[model samples]
Target: MSTIVIKRSQAVWQDRTRAYTAWVDGKAVGRLEHGASLSVPVGAGEHEVQMRIDWCTSPALSVSVPVGGTVELECGPNANALLALLYITLWRHRYIWLKPATTE
Candidate 1:
């Protein structure tokens, strides 16, 4: 098996104290709080990763995990506190962002 590490940034003004649900290939594997992280184990191969909070969610991210290796990802609300309302109401799928940490 391989591991996928997902971290959530500390956004004091956005979803400050709640946890985001971590979904791997459509299954809820774990949760991530502001400024926190979680590790999920899965077979080493191609998979989809996403983050959700109620009906808000990040677009699915495609990933490939090498045998017995680990991959790291990071996520946070795509919009700041001021724009959160517009994000969830007008662009739910883009409310949060999930991508490889190296891409940040």
Candidate 2:
């Protein structure tokens, strides 16, 4: 098995709404906030790792972790874009769900 560590850096903006969902092959594995760290279990081999915020998704990182080793991911600037996209997407989803009831 392999271990993965995700690290987030602080943004200058006061916004704390930024949260990233970590995915493996389009499946969500876990989530972490900006400046937070999350550890995940992985298998040895080349794996596609992704981070998504709202509707925007980060470029998939091809990571190869050795057996019983660790891989550290530094989630940086792109976080802002990721977060913005996610917020808009979620808002749309919420509107779509809530509007139907009120309109009826």
Candidate 3:
């Protein structure tokens, strides 16, 4: 088995109290809270992951995991307080961000 680990950031001013739904291969697996990390097990190979709340969702993140390997990802709302309105009204689907963790 392989693991998809997702770490969510803490956004004090944006959706701080809400939880994002974690999706793997288009199925809702669990709720990922702010500033929390979750691990979802999957068969080895490629998969698509997403984090979303209602109409707001991050771009899909594609990953390949070897047998017994792990893929780490980070996600959060892309909209800050100032950009929240714009994101809500314009790019609802891009309101969140999901990507491979490089900056840590």
Q: Which residue window of length 10 is worst by lDDT in model 1?
A: 9-18
User: Candidate 2 — which pairs collide?
Assistant: 53-86, 54-86, 55-85
Clashes of 1: 0
The digit string of per-residue lDDT tens for model 1 on 15-99 reads 8878899999999999898899999999999999999999999999999999999999999988876887889898999999888
Evaluate residue 39 in candidate 1 and report its C-alpha lDDT on the 0 to 100 scale. 94
For candidate 2, lDDT tens digit of each residue in 48-85?
A: 77766665555677778799988777664432455655
lDDT at residue 47 of model 1 (Cα atoms): 93
Q: Tell me how candidate 3 scores on lDDT.
A: 0.90
Better lDDT candidate (2, 3)? 3
User: Which is the winner by TM-score between candidate 2 and candidate 3?
Assistant: 3
**CA shift at 26, candidate 1, in angstroms?**
0.6
Off by over 4 Å in 2: 79-104
lDDT of 3 by residue, 1-104 (tens): 89999999888778888999999999998898889999999999999999999888888888998899999999999998678888887888789999998863
